[model samples]
Target: MLTTKLGVLLSGRGVVAGDRVRDALADAGLTMRSAFTLTQLAAGPVNQQTLIDLLGVDPSAVVTVLNELEGRGLVSRQRDPADRRRHIVVMTADGTRTLHTVEEVLDKTDDDLFAALTPRERDQLERLLTKVADADSCAEKY
Candidate 1:
């Protein structure tokens, strides 16, 4: 039963279902998935390579996403003052507002996603998921 459930959860339906959540978020103009780039930028100025590592996306893809965000006046990328060889990306005021909107949407999305779970179960799930995320990074270092 456990194996069957795991297999189903790993199937395309599960993937698409998760995509639907992002789609719904994007439909509102927040674009939560790509906004990870903006959110990372919002943290502080980070170079393109840093975004690539943070988002785990291809270099070309990262450039494309940054281009779109820049075109929208949401972000700015410039030659790092201290490191001419690297470009630093930073969020504008608009980007900060948009990131806040995305956070609100994410809060709603999470509530909807975990609607079936009790508060205690939700806490347990968060702990377990954090552990899994940590393990993934640890695996990458090995």
Candidate 2:
């Protein structure tokens, strides 16, 4: 019963946070889907295969997402200099701006979500979450 309650609470919080982020992105004149895709590309230069691996999606789906991003001029793809046949994905200036906005929204969401905790409690919570995230079992889930 406790586990079920925790699951429901977590899912509800996730949905609310997602809605906030989507609204924030829309206010910044960007789509939430595009913002997410662009931010992923901004993390580093990645090939389609890398994106597929990171996103846990099929190659064709990733290609479709990349194509949409490219069409919006939010992301650019270039042939890898070392491997001309392979393409590398990079964020454009617009994408960088959108990513910055999204990050701000995420920061605010974090602050709001943890507002009930004292500063020390927040720090402890963060440490515990990070530890769980770095656990072997957690890595396997990813």
Candidate 3:
């Protein structure tokens, strides 16, 4: 018997969608973590510690990601004027362009995932999900 549980269904669908998104991002030469980093900097500069905390990863892992992004000219780290010991991460023009590409890729993935839904249904679903996401403080950055 099929269980009628929204949480279970949503979790399963989320995993599938996540995989699809990861694959699409990979084609654009980005990983989820790297794309997230760029997305965070899209708003403005953030100190390295902020990134590390946002990413919830080892400091070294964040450094590796930063190194790769810097090497690609997507981002740069500059010493913060307020605090010389802290390095602020800023997205470059190239990174902005790449972030746009990432958005397009995610949009495509959304379309693919919601292909079964009618336009109206998609809109309704988005509204409902937005409400849920809005309730979560962490969703603001995402």
- Top of the candidates by lDDT: 3
Please give the ranking of all candidate structures by TM-score, highest first, separated by commas: 3, 1, 2
- All candidates: TM-score: 0.79, 0.71, 0.80
Per-residue lDDT of 78-103 in model 3, one digit per residue for the tens? 99999999999999999999999999
lDDT of candidate 2 over 1-142, digit per residue (tens) = 7657965877787798768777776777666556656767877789867777776656786688788778878788999999998899999897787678778877787788778999899899789867866674534321
TM for candidate 1 is: 0.79
The best candidate in terms of TM-score: 3
* Model 3 CA deviation exceeding 4 Å by range: 53-58, 130-142
Q: lDDT of each model, Cα atoms only?
A: 0.76, 0.75, 0.90
Residue 75's C-alpha lDDT in candidate 3? 99
Candidate 3 lands at a TM-score of 0.80
Rank order (by lDDT, best first): 3, 1, 2
**Cα lDDT for residue 112, model 1?**
75
**Which residue pairs show collisions in model 2?**
none
Q: Which candidate do you rate higher for lDDT, 1 or 3?
A: 3
Error of 3 at 72 (Å): 1.8
